[model samples]
Target: MRITAENFIKHLKKNREEALQYVIDEYIGIVKAIIYNALKSYNDPQIIEECISDTFLGAYENAKQFKGDKEDFRKWICTIAKYKAITKQRKLSKAPFFYEIDETGNAVKSAEDEYLIKSSTEELLMMMSQLEQLDRDIFTMKYFLNMKNEEIAEHCGLTKAAINNRLYRGKKRLQQIHLGGSMS
Candidate 1:
């Protein structure tokens, strides 16, 4: 049967399995696409998967608040996915490290390392902002959401190969710009 927001809400209110399943089955592709596009820049796929799961769980918990059209739902999900991706990125950047100073009056822990990381973080954010909206979306989904190319393709109405191509080119461009700016 076809599922609408009204029906979905009814299922959610009643805590029906079918409704939850309907949402999962129908919207998983869309959710995956939203997630993957929002997280494409992250190098760790595991973190992206966790964030994607968190995004879906958040949607499930807050499904009752979805009081808009289907398109609005899509946008809302995408927004949540993007926010989750950014949060994860911030977490990665803030990851702690231990350093020890060796002998010879040389400092093993240097201030330059900190500055380089800080600068790279800023450069990444700046380069992300410079990307086209569509490219940003694709990047987020692939990297932050940990989605496979086929799923993104289905959700975005593109072929699997096309999604792969877009992701490849987008990543190459982002890396070039970000690294090049930092080096310069």
Candidate 2:
């Protein structure tokens, strides 16, 4: 039998393997795009692929609880992909850094490089802490997760204009903090 959006949930409940395969074939591109955008800072294909697999696993496991048609399924899977990638990114950020040796026997990621990256990220987070929670969330979603204003607004239950305004204001505040030499 040919599987389609209308019958996807039914298939998922009845034959998970087939439904999963169908979902993989149909929505892999969307999932990959969302995951890639979320984990772009990593620049690691293996991590991205792992997050993709986790997303499909999550969707498959939660299929029984899902409702709505194909469009909703697309959105749902995209959300799964995004959150999974973000979770992985957080774990990686907290994990220890691994270094490689170059052909000339120099560490690819030197101590200075590691210190700069770590300090910069720490400094940015410290600066972000000065903003209101909503503004910080908007900035994280927009810059770190690569979400569009519409997506951020939807997630935050605000209008796109409001999201844009918050982002603008947030940047100005962070700029002031940065310029004032308040970051230590």
Most TM-score-accurate candidate: 2
**TM-scores, each model vs. reference:** 0.45, 0.55
Q: Candidate 1, 171: how far from true, in Å?
A: 31
Clashes of each: 16, 0
Once superposed on the true structure, which residue ranges of model 2 sit more than 4 Å away at CA?
97-184
- Candidate 1 regions with alpha-carbon error over 4 angstroms: 1-6, 13-17, 97-184
Residue-by-residue lDDT tens digits, candidate 2, 1-184: 7787778778986656888999999999988988887787888898899989988887787676566567656765665676677667765765455556577864465677556654554466557657766786677678656789999989989999999898887888898898984432
TM-score of candidate 2 versus the correct structure, residues matched by position: 0.55
For each candidate, the alpha-carbon lDDT, in order, equals: 0.63, 0.74
